[model samples]
Target: MRRFFAYLTAFIREDFNLRLYAGTAAFVAAMTAFNYAVDLEDGIIDKHRGEVLRFWLYAGLDAFMYYSVTVFWLLANRQLSILKTARFWLFSLAAIGVLAWWQDYTGYSKVVGLPVFGEIYSFAHYCFSNLSSALTVWVPFAVFYLLVDRQPSHFYGFRPDWLSLKMYGILLLLMVPLIAWASFQPSFLQTYPIYKGWGAARALHWPEWIPAVIFELCYGFDFISTELIFRGFLIIGMMQVVGRGAVLPMVAVYATVHFGKPLGETIGSVFGGYILGVLAYQSRTIWGGIAVHLGVAWLMELGAFLQSFVHSPEK
Candidate 1:
């Protein structure tokens, strides 16, 4: 047991730069506080109260925990630059659009708002949904560029363009089963069918070409934003101090960011983020990961757009 504890302690220290005793204590304290806030009284009168409290507790816990981890990783690695340059922001937006489209197509539009809201609320929600999803990519991208700013000179310069091509071929071959499984996972939440209103109710449902074009544009923003935040900022930032070992924190944080996702996508993201981080780190260029990321993302978005069109009774 002593040896086991030692091993566990060493693992956190090595993987997350976490000092075992203090980190363990901190985690326990946080969890205890979270649980206390979410506890329910065993009576009917408090049922709704309990549920609302639980919801808020979980939400707060998630946000706080994520922030804590990022802070911990940054401090351990000693990243001085918290904000990145303009070039990074530009690239990040491009990446977010591509990625967001891909996830949408893969039926990962779980982030979407419910279709039932009063006109003003719905209009505001729709505007925010598109706008927020479109712009939120900067968060992670800024983090990544800062983290990688101090990387050693020899970290980059590997070129296997042919290898990348071959790997993509393999991915294409495998994507058939992968996509099928991803698309059909059951959701308890029922999604609204495509509504064809213009502007306010502007149904994103119209000629496939028209909506597709608009979606593609929106998606470009969405995908790049996401990538910039996760792949570019969060992952890259952690890598500075963690070195190649940074993949540990990178995957953990990436998966958590998708905590809003369904189980399958969340699970998929853990593995996917790991692979993308490794590829990005190895190539010393985000290009390889970008290509793969963009390719998969676009395919997913296109699929979702088409499915909504085909399945919409109104259309």
Candidate 2:
């Protein structure tokens, strides 16, 4: 295990340079081509059916290909110390391959719109989307490594306790006010949609518990992936360079990701991302942010549920 880690480290440091970034760029390009390819075949039924196949192909296959190419390129560059140890590289590749496949199959990256390349101001759009969607994770990682990791010397006054449930409690407390404010707003109930299963409840109102659970369970996959990609991987990776200040980039990326959102909501999301980015940096764990993330998703789902209750004709 020690030797394997050594090789992995070497590979990452030496071979895993801008090539990985290039591979990711390729993934973006393929996704765009596939989408446009599908769109062009709108008239023919057989061609239209290819869209679904292409969606999975470009989405799933491309992710694996990207990861594989990066790893292989790292090995070829002799960046991996113990390329002699086939077990290590194989295991690492297998794990990431599985994760990439699962994420693609679930359509996690679908919302990350095509990067507008040179076409019609596409380059700017592409840059913004990439920066917003994936680059955010690199920032927090940089900050944690620079500021937090190097500060182990001041252990006694570090205030590690603040990184506990107290922080989580504070988050919950803050959420209460936002929830209250949203609930009281007349327009709050109409802003989001809640899907109700086709049942007797369609004809009349029913307890929202079931639909809330259903929606949360279903949509939660994509939500968690977004958090993992943006908050977990990107920020964590970037922390290697920028140290603690990486949160700034994370927030910027987070805000940009929501550019398609309404101004007020987009601004609010940036604030939320900033808060989550801090927690991630402080705790050195994405799980903390994931918990907060799940909470926010639940709140959104709850808000949707309340909307149903408020808007029902029976009400």
Candidate 3:
């Protein structure tokens, strides 16, 4: 317990800027509330199949929100000149747009012959889709290290945590029952295993193992991206800018990202983000956050699968 408190104390002791943190949090909160309102409006409308103009519009808006919040704090710190930041944003957005578009292009245009559902093409698409978002966020960071920043990636705090495995294991074990019990909740069950849409899993024309394998890989990738962005990039990358204050706004944005997920999860994410952020700040690594995230995520997947396997009716 003494060790745990000490670890937390170090996390809080960093050279924090409270004003910057508060301003960033307010920006995220307002934007998130706006997004939620838009989402509610979108939910009420019925659209034709394959008509995703609304979806694209919302995605673009969300991207803009992310960019706004990101640049606000970076500007507050005055680390980079205006021209450099402009250049960074231009490259970063373009890369992400290309990756997002490439998913559709590769799935539709490049696959030999017409892409059929539940076939090899679909499986390839699913697997790559998992990795695409991770790569989109990762590329700029990598480029920054190699070309611009020139510091080791560890400067962004990707090293092994001082309390990595031990802390993660303890949290994982503690979360076991709460996560399992939530799995049985109607709201939770509905949103969980959000990877259900691949449909290839049930298309018996394909080998049974193919969809499962792709799904598991995608599942792992989703959490990896989540950790890298929220815990690694947001907290550590911004640490020099806002110091320990970075963690708060990161927590705000992190929790808001889960706004469309289950209510329990959205609420849980706020607490979980804080805990993981503290660990990342103290240990100088997001590895522990990744471990905790993956463990809890996989456990929820297993729990949801088991309930369905046992034919438990939704509560």
Candidate 4:
């Protein structure tokens, strides 16, 4: 815990520019407010879900605007230099665009339509959709790392270190009460546990827990991809270009990506993304972030599950 605070304090002391931080915060707050007010993500971007190019374009532009604007602010303030690294920025934005597109992409619906999968299509589709994030997000970034980054260290924070795990666990423990409180909210319940089973259990004559457990595993895996992208790729990978200035831009865009989620969660992401970005920057490892993320995510699932079970009419 002390170590975590030390890292955060050091980063802030060295990197905290009042104007830049305030400007970025204001930008993020306004963007978040407008997004929720207009239901931008659900009403606007997601409306093009199945239209591959259109969805990609909308999601990509949304992410690009948030990220680019923050970076632009950094540039305007003389905090970042894009002189020779134009290609890196372009590639990074393109990769973020691809990830945004892939995240909500509905192209997999075609596969779910096949008759071979039978009544279990819902279960299969749910699992496949979540699991595919690993491929979509990681593959492009991996290629980028090999071709461009080729950093001498481990692959964007995948290196193992058992020492930090305890700190991460304590962080997760601290989040327990907050997550439990969220579970009782009308909005949180509406979105959480993420797997409705889509009637897969009834159709297949299988226990609901089977599909739920499988879905939870896949859902948890998506967080690994998330940590890799936001904490690992965006913060660590971009640090080479922007130095410690990478954290806020990543936080702004990270919050943007959460627009479709419950409002509180979206708001929480700004803080969460910032903390994880700073920690990742300091430790040069994403494993701790991964642990805390997966732990909090799964805890939310559990809380939602327990809430549902307790409130079920059958009970």
Worst 10 residues of 1 by lDDT: 188-197
What is the C-alpha lDDT profile of model 1 across 22-90, one tens digit per residue?
A: 453365345434334544112221343323453343334344444454445456556524425454334
Model 1 misses residue 315 by how many Å? Answer: 12
Model 1 segments beyond 4 Å from truth?
1-169, 181-208, 304-315
Give per-residue lDDT, candidate 1, residue 210: 59
Q: Tell me the TM-score of each prediction against the true structure.
A: 0.50, 0.46, 0.69, 0.89
What is candidate 2's local distance difference test score? 0.46
lDDT of 2 by residue, 81-154 (tens): 44355543443333233333432232323333434322323223322333432333334333543664454432
Q: Lowest-scoring 10 consecutive residues by lDDT in candidate 2?
A: 153-162
The residue-by-residue lDDT of candidate 3 on 266-285, one tens digit each, is: 66776678778887877778
Best by TM-score: 4
- The TM-score-based order of candidates, best leading, equals 4, 3, 1, 2
Give candidate 3's whole-model lDDT: 0.62
Q: Alpha-carbon error at 36 in model 1, in Å?
A: 16
Per-residue lDDT of model 4, residues 1-315, tens digit only: 998899899999988777777777877788888988988888877777677655665666556655665575567557555645686566567557656766666766777779976787877888878788766787878887888777798998887877777778788899999999989999889888777778887887888888788788888888898898888888888777777766887888788788888787888898999999998999888999999988988898889989989999999
| Deviation from native of the Cα of residue 295 in model 4, angstroms | 1.0
| Stretches > 4 Å off in candidate 4 | 52-56, 59-63, 66-73, 76-80, 205-207, 313-315
Note each model's CA RMSD in angstroms.
Answer: 11.4, 15.2, 5.4, 2.4
Q: lDDT of all predictions, in order shown? A: 0.46, 0.46, 0.62, 0.80
